[model samples]
Target chain A: MQFDVRLFALYRERAGASIVTIDLPEGASAGDLTAAVRADYPRLAPPEVRIVVAVNAEYADDDQLLQPGDEVCLIPPVSGGC
Target chain B: MIILTDEPLDPVAVTDSVRRDGNGAVVTFLGTTRDNFGGKEVTRLEYEAYDVMAIKKLQEVRDTLRADYGIEDIAIAHRTGRVDVGHISLVVAVASPHRVQAFEACHEAVNRIKTIVPIWKKEWFADGSRWVACEDHEFADEAEHAHAHAERHAVAAGD
Candidate 1:
């Protein structure tokens, strides 16, 4: 299955691209997607940066399963000033 | 409660929208454009949004507050487009039987909006502009991790 992932804020800057398309095997979980992102993009590896993932506009946990055509977004730390 | 606007926000109107006779306490929070962020002098602010997500998230916050506090009425409005210094960018109002609930609900509403909403602000300084994201309590660590991850990937890619 194929999923379209969005990178926002600093992630967008780091990726140098706003969107990335990832191909995952059947029955992939959010964790699988994260690992793929880390492996492919390299900018996603640990020290385990907390990147919030939204699947089709709803927040999803790492263990959440991904369906085909789900809109995935990697939300970086927001910069709302104090 | 209505949660969106492109025009300048009116705090009085937002407050009035939620006022009730049984509710003795009404708390309103107005987030305005400031002239400075850190050391940079902000001339103005430009707000953008993934409108669909922003509105949905704003409504979710309103619903959560209503459920958690037993708040009767609430209103949340956020301004988009160019807003000059001191102009209101966001407004949140809540009314309840007691002052404590009103205050607490209002505070939580605004905090949730800032943290979860998809709205983005670009601070235009004299020299340049930068996009602002919602800052969380654990922002520094998250930023460091994101930076390191990106750097490692870049190195592997031989960029």
Candidate 2:
């Protein structure tokens, strides 16, 4: 299965690609995809960084099941407004 | 009027969006780029947002205000791209029949935007630049959050 993971903020800067697709084995969880990306883009963040992945615009659990073409997003710590 | 614009945000237009016959009180809040942070001379601020999700969160903020305060005519405009010092970057406008609800709702709306919206603020000073935290008050590279975000949420889930 292929997972389209969207990147933002620091991840975007480090990965240099806003959206990257990861190929995973069948029945891999969201956590598995996150680990794959962390391995692929080791420089995306320091070793201490563990990125949260969102599925279909909402934060998803590590064990959440995958679906084809689900809108997945990486959320960075956000600070906005007055 | 929940929006994220790269152009200069117009306070008057956003305020105008919420005006209606029954609304007597219109409360508007403008967030401007400041020239200083931690007493350091700052140049300009760059703002970014996750457009689709940000709008969804803005709508959620609008719904919360309507349900909690019974105010429907509410508008929020946020600026993206580069915002100069002394320029308006955020506008929260709310119209209500009573002055109190307008004030209260508008106040809560700004807070919600800060809390929920996936908007990031980066400040540039003469020496360097850093991303500001919404509530954590940490000086670490705000952008560095990409790496630690999942772990942070793990702690949040535990809390």
Candidate 3:
């Protein structure tokens, strides 16, 4: 299955594109997608820094399953002033 | 109803939407564009959003607050496009039978909106413009990891 993943904020800048489509196995979890992302984008791999993910616009756990048409978004920490 | 508009936000209208006869306590919070952020002089602030997702997420926030606090009435409005300094950017109004619930719900609503909403804001400073929350990308990445893991296992099990 192929899923459209969105990158925002710093990730978007680093990725140089707002969205990317990646091919995954039929049943891929959010973690698998993260690994795939790290594999695809070495800049986003672990140990350097962590990135947050939102599946279908809501925060999803690493164990959460994704549907084909689900909107997967990568949100960086907000730097807004309170 | 959840509102996503380019027009300036109105706190009074948002407050009115949450006003209920049975609820004695109403708490309203308005988020505005400040003149400065982290020592930078902000000339203006620009907000952008995936409107469809933003509205859906806003509605989810409203529903969650209602369920968690038993708040019958709530309203959340966020502004898009350019907003001048001191202008309202977001408004959240929540009503409950008691003051505590109203206050708690209102705070949670705002916090969740900031954390989960798809809207993005760019602060145009005198020197440069920066996207808010550009550094923290771990939350969404983790979510994606979890979702992918779930899908993989499900496929293995043929479910």
Judging by DockQ against the true structure, name the best candidate.
2
DockQ leaderboard ranking: 2, 1, 3
lDDT of each: 0.73, 0.79, 0.72
Tens digits of per-residue lDDT, candidate 1, B1-159, equal 675777877789899999988989989888888898666688998876656667878888888888898877999888878889999888888999889999999888877776677666777889876655444223323445435543343233221
lDDT tens per residue, model 1, A35-74 = 8887788864354454567788776787889998788887
lDDT of prediction 1:
0.73
Please give, for residues B1-159, the per-residue lDDT of candidate 2 as tens digits. Answer: 788889998899999999999989999999998898767777999988888888888889899889999778999999888899999989999999989999999999988888777777888898887666556544333444532553364335312
In candidate 2, stretches whose alpha carbon ends up further than 4 angstroms from where it belongs are A43-50, B138-159
* Candidate 1: clashing pairs of residues: A42-B153, A43-B149, A43-B150, A78-B133, A78-B134, A79-B133, A79-B134, A80-B133
Number of the top candidate by TM-score?
A: 2
lDDT by residue for model 3 (B85-147), tens: 999888888888889998998888887787566677777877666555423333223444533
To one decimal, what is the Cα RMSD in angstroms of model 1 from the true structure? 5.9
Model 2 agreement with the true structure over A13-54: per-residue lDDT tens digits: 779999988998888887888888988988765555456667
Rank order (by TM-score, best first): 2, 1, 3
Docking verdict class for candidate 2:
medium
Task: Please provide TM-scores, in order, for all candidate models, with all chains considered together.
Answer: 0.79, 0.85, 0.75
Worst 10 residues of 3 chain B by lDDT: B150-159
Model with the higher DockQ, candidate 1 or 3: 1
Predicted complex 3: CAPRI docking category? incorrect
Q: Record all residue pairs in model 2 with backbone atoms less than 3 Å apart, i.e. clashing.
A: A49-B147, A50-B147
**lDDT score, candidate 2:** 0.79
